[model samples]
Target chain A: MSAPVIFDPMTLPSDDNVNAYTFCVELKGGEWFLQKGKMIAYYGRIEFNGIGHGRFERLLRTSFHSPLHASDWVVAQGSGKMLLADRAFDVNSYDLEDGNLTIRSGNLLAYQPTLALKQSIVPGFLTLIGTGKFVAASNGPVVFMEPPIRVDPQALVGWADCPSPCHHYDHGYMTGVLGGLRSLTGLGGTSGEEHQFEFVGAGTVLLQSTEMLMAEQATGAVPHEPGVPGGGAGVPGSGHAGQGAAPRLPGQLGDLQRRFGL
Target chain B: MLAVDMSGDSVKAKNGSMVAYDGQMAFKKMSGGGEGLRGMVTRRLTGEQMTVMEVRGQGTCYFADRASEINLVSLHGDKLYVEASNLLCTDAGLRTGTTFTGLRGGATGNGLFTTTVEGMGQAAIMSDGPAVILRVTPQYPLSVDPGAYIAHQGNLQQHFQAGVTFRTLIGEGGGEAFQIRFEGDGLVYVQPSERNTIGGDV
Candidate 1:
């Protein structure tokens, strides 16, 4: 049976533009409570990103520190099935050391092109944050100024001409001491093979928070990889906790990529 | 970063032609005989005032600064247009325009100005998406985000109205209301969502 729609169109903001995209939720085992009334919303000028593919599930909540004027209205909400385009969501993400905000989403298409920054482009302060199970198709060409902003390994937009930061994700253990420290501090440090993606352009970065890889390890849900269709909820997540998280390097990346059809 | 300022100027766009403003104006003649109307609407001018007229076939536009004072027009071309009846100098922006800027405070009623796109380059209006000009027959359906509306298709027009007695508010009136009711058919262009907060978290 079709799930009954509950939204009152007449009740929507009078000035709002809406089409008859009516339908509450249509699923069997799909819990409506987990999905209904949940929508991503914002009151700012956000350009569009591209298409994306992956199992996505995140819960985010942000409240303003003070009563902001109307010029910048406060916003909240989330997404479930994200239809992102190519180049819309970069494979990697960046860490905005300055004014980056945390977010969770079902799909996030940052208008910021997921490409390497140009040699001339200076790495500025604005950032693009996203929180979802993102598996980008492009590794990226992150470009920026001499000393570009430090980018997070997992949270990246794109890259530049020549990429660097190929070092160990940590200075200590392959899976123990370093991994422990990384988790303890949430510091995405580096090592020999670890590379921090860089952007060398006049672009903004989108950001979000996710433990999709870790969540999968704990919940046994595999995410749908790019080339691989369906099921972003069964694989053993990367960075599994101590004895439980997915294994370290040597074979982990390959195994995950294979299952994800990368 | 999108903020709707209620304050702005109601400079003149003589039906069609498009032109720019340089803090100065030159008002021409105005009989103000809007087809359905019975008489010529009279007007008065202030310190800074002028009139403009876009002759029928001359496809061009004119402009004026945010504080330029203006009034009704004589049918230079397609005269009656827009979602509301008023468009003018008002002050309703995020930051009141100081000496550097001028915002005629208050919201202009919704409606369409027949000026060329250039005439509207600096003009902001609410629409469904890329505005679709319609023939306004009784058959076609016309709908739009009250916020994206510029004008409707007929003499039957509606602009920004205050109060929830006519609408339901989630928190409070967005200050932007819903459905600028238009009985006949017309056109509207608007972004995918009037309340779209996509890339950044507002």
Candidate 2:
């Protein structure tokens, strides 16, 4: 009968951390269903060099609250908007438009072959050639929203929601050495901050912190105003404690039946 | 050679690793540097195949040939953080740590990381910067740059999509395009703004 006076995850039974900032909520009503909607993303500005370089802190999500069931969502801000259907929820929108939504989740981003799910048009899978070949994936059907979602490097898969399949570029340790050399002589060298993968689509966007990252994060590994810190060559800045085999958090992909609660 | 013109990001660090905007997935050396007197090179390269040799220290440095990619021994310090976005590959890793999942609201771990500062220190140790985090919720839908992302919970459904005309236009550009979009509710970790400063991000 009335729009929620205050939409927030805090109002629900939260089993999360405020500093760690992970919260969860379940729906009160509604049975199983499939949700769909056009995705329009407007990614906010990014912050760089231990500074608030990211534009619009005011854009910080005030209420990370969502409905448990598939509901209709629309892009309410930025350059445009789109209508996603009654299946899932919109996590957080961006400044750019994912443009449109086409496919449902089903092993969309794995090294495994696309499992030909009905009439197929894959929009959630991305393949890129890094030191190790990998794919970007989602948990299930991606929804639409106004502002883009802020993501952690650990959960990001890529940004290539294009028509043609994604290609991987190989650059073994040899190239890293060569690139490392060039930066010294000023021949060529980016701050290593200008790198990004492309994933073009308006499908369900899956993401979460890798288990490996969590291991270190809980200790406040971020560079803060600490006592004079050391500098690791490729690693940079120092305030960490441990050596030998850092943990790794592998990425993943999934499908629909299990995602939308159908 | 389809280079996606890239720019602007006031968000987080998980996306520090970026490719050339002109459209190309080739990994090229961008630059190099070092810690103590030994060998190290820095160059600009493209693609995800490139490996960024990160070093954390406060000591005398040296110059060497481009042959040696990284100085494994020189990464010593209090807490050396490098943005993983540009990192092509690591020697090895393990999914040994905490977790946060489910979709409720504008999640994305509230647009932050899941592990506590003190907790992540156990892992972010020897690494630079904080963990770039992401959260997915029922209401707040989020998409992230793959390269910048570190690790995500293992309950999402990863899929691909086509680009451009898939929406406003039709039947153009050879068949259809593809993209990586996720659904469900979970947290995606990432650096706030800083990235893996390979070559000379320090």
Candidate 3:
């Protein structure tokens, strides 16, 4: 057996990836906003402080805008090279130039302080604004595709630039009595790909090769505003989309008449 | 998967790790990791027990463990300290023994005793992902999260460091409050994924 390559601070790349599953970020008396518990190792002098620390009040006010996710984030400061990885997933760093990118909250690993982090209006997503570098992890290699395409919800990783994203249900399979019956009860052969997320306008959509998703991070509850998607919804046990409320039998055909406005 | 061609020389591997083999091969379970009676007693008392088997043959033997990534470490007389569970196979000429590791072992949830292999031979360790080998120097000390640490070699001094303050009690402590600081010169092996450690929540 032979020893693997041993990397030192001098040999480690600056603000780049060490491999497909690990990324190295070099800090020269600067700071990076990191997700809690994502740091694997580091060399030199570096201090990790929670976002609620008193000294970071000003920094938090400027860049850290999502108060609900405060507990899951921290600020890494000082001079050192740190290694970040998540669940052995493929990690990559992207540079944003005075632009915004929306990503799944769990996929994001760390970002520069120059970028402002905010919760996206769409649930379970985060938007980073300004010009800086941010690291993200995916179950597999991420593929960049132009908009004007529909992507499976589980395969979508994120999107860069402005694009209108909305739900696109296959009207042919979702309308009519037979379509509704097929969806409500798996009779008459219901293809699982009847629904997708449609993206239009100009932007880049990121997709992972595998449909397996990383464990979803708690994005925190949105404000109880009237127009919010998940805000007006009550407790999870009360049931919003017919899940957890009751166990329907195989041939029950759940809410088919209501869906058809019969 | 690790494939080793053996021409009469034997190798000690984890029991039940042989996946497939071709040609001539003899598999025998070595009692007490082939370390005699004293090693058995020490391993039983220290709770660092590992069941190893000796494979000697004239053909090719394949070894695998749960489809994990295998890392090869070459040792030229320096001692390799690793968790018993992470050790897969080693040259039969190497000496395997149990040693006390104090607080660092407790932090990793691997007990207070660790397995040490020494000699001029090669050993294979298993990890969830490919291990990253980081070189530690006297000038640049390395601090690692306990959950991600796997093994280390060469002259190194490790200290189990903890940062606990009033903020920690209020759940506002830094997420990386518990870490293992390694100084001196050595090579540290870290997996890209973290195991659930005792100090993981802190």
Give the chain A TM-score for each candidate: 0.22, 0.20, 0.90
Off by over 4 Å in 1: A1-71, A74-128, A131-262, B1-38, B42-80, B83-148, B154-179, B189-202
Point out where model 3 deviates above 4 Å: A1-3, A233-255, A259-262
**Per-candidate DockQ vs. reference:** 0.01, 0.02, 0.81
DockQ of 3: 0.81
Instruction: For candidate 1, write residues A1-262 as lDDT tens digits.
Output: 1221222222222212222211111122211111111122212121111111011121111211211111222111122221111211222323333233322222212212221111111111111332212122122232334324455545443332223423234334335444544544547753433444443434443322431211111112233443222233334565433323333443244434444566
lDDT score of residue A68 within candidate 3: 88
What's the CA error at residue A33 for candidate 1, in Å?
A: 20
What fraction of the native interface does candidate 2 get right in terms of contacts? Answer: 0.01
- Sort the predicted structures by lDDT, highest score first: 3, 1, 2
Model 2 lDDT per residue over A113-181, tens place: 111112122222212211211121233323232213433333443232333222222242114444434
The worst-scoring run of ten residues by lDDT in candidate 1 chain A lies at A47-56
In model 2, what is the error at residue A42, expressed in angstroms?
Answer: 8.7
